[model samples]
Target: MAASSGRFESAKSIEERKEQTRIARAEVLRQAKANFEKEERWKELKRLRGEDTWMLPDVNEQIEQFSKAIAMAFSRKPT
Candidate 1:
């Protein structure tokens, strides 16, 4: 009975560690995309108003893709 209890505790600890890693990774991705969006929007708005400037649509696409990836990762959690 004691051995079984120890094994159970070890397994529970591993599960918890995995959860923490997932949460941290998600937050990092969210922050990175947010920063990119802030800068991109400023440039895009300027370009839209016919300013003599340029914008990278590829960055916009990456922001969209990263957002989706974060959402999917969170959704897979064993709530």
Candidate 2:
């Protein structure tokens, strides 16, 4: 990430924008980490579908659900 250039006007508000930015960044990273496993599963499912694996349990529905869940997760504001 690029460093914030606070070269403009001096202090006005007591609230620190840097802290808010850090919190937002951390939340985004946390969400990405939580979703990483789902992404891997989706990729694996695709790969297995490409192969001749007939004994594998059906996971296409679950993958679709995961996609929806990921969308919901990203659409909400971090609490």
Candidate 3:
């Protein structure tokens, strides 16, 4: 019974630590995004210039497409 209780405490501590790290990572990503907008770096990029900006493609979907294209290209045998 004592050993089981000790294992439970350790498991709880590990979960708490993981939750703390997850929150910290989310905060850092939020700050980085805010800094980018504050600097207007995206505005200077010509490709994004004069765009409605409100309408944007899903980033994850775009990345998935890119990954699939790369995989298809690499899977072909060299002549």
Candidate 4:
């Protein structure tokens, strides 16, 4: 049993559509790979700089406070 809706597409058109989809997928993959590589390079550069920008000033102040607390703890004699 066949239902004739009178709409048809050639095999060549199907192949062309498949090829276009494949190309689009390849491009998306390439872009993702490029982004990953760029991020890796950025991290490497930051690592080489020996610090992660030291964070913001308030963050630095908190770190200093923690350090002071730790130092004070160590200085206290054990009961």
Off by over 4 Å in 1: 1-9, 49-79
Q: Report backbone clashes per prediction.
A: 0, 0, 0, 0
18-73: candidate 1 lDDT, tens digit per residue: 99999999999999999999999988997788573344668767888999999999
TM-score of 4: 0.60
The Cα local distance difference test for each model comes to: 0.85, 0.76, 0.79, 0.90
For lDDT, the strongest prediction is 4
RMSD for each of the candidates: 17.1, 16.8, 12.6, 8.1
Comparing 2 with 3 on TM-score, the higher-scoring candidate is 3
Which pairs, if any, clash in model 2?
Answer: none
When summed lDDT is taken over every stretch of 10 residues in candidate 3, the lowest stretch is: 46-55
lDDT of 3 by residue, 1-79 (tens): 7776653457789899999999999999999999988668656664467363444568656887999999999999999
| Residue 72 of model 2, lDDT score | 98
* Candidate 2 local Cα displacement, residue 24, angstroms: 0.3
- Report the C-alpha displacement of residue 74, candidate 4, in angstroms: 23
lDDT of 4 by residue, 1-79 (tens): 2436656788899999999999999999999999999999999998788566568868888999999999999999999
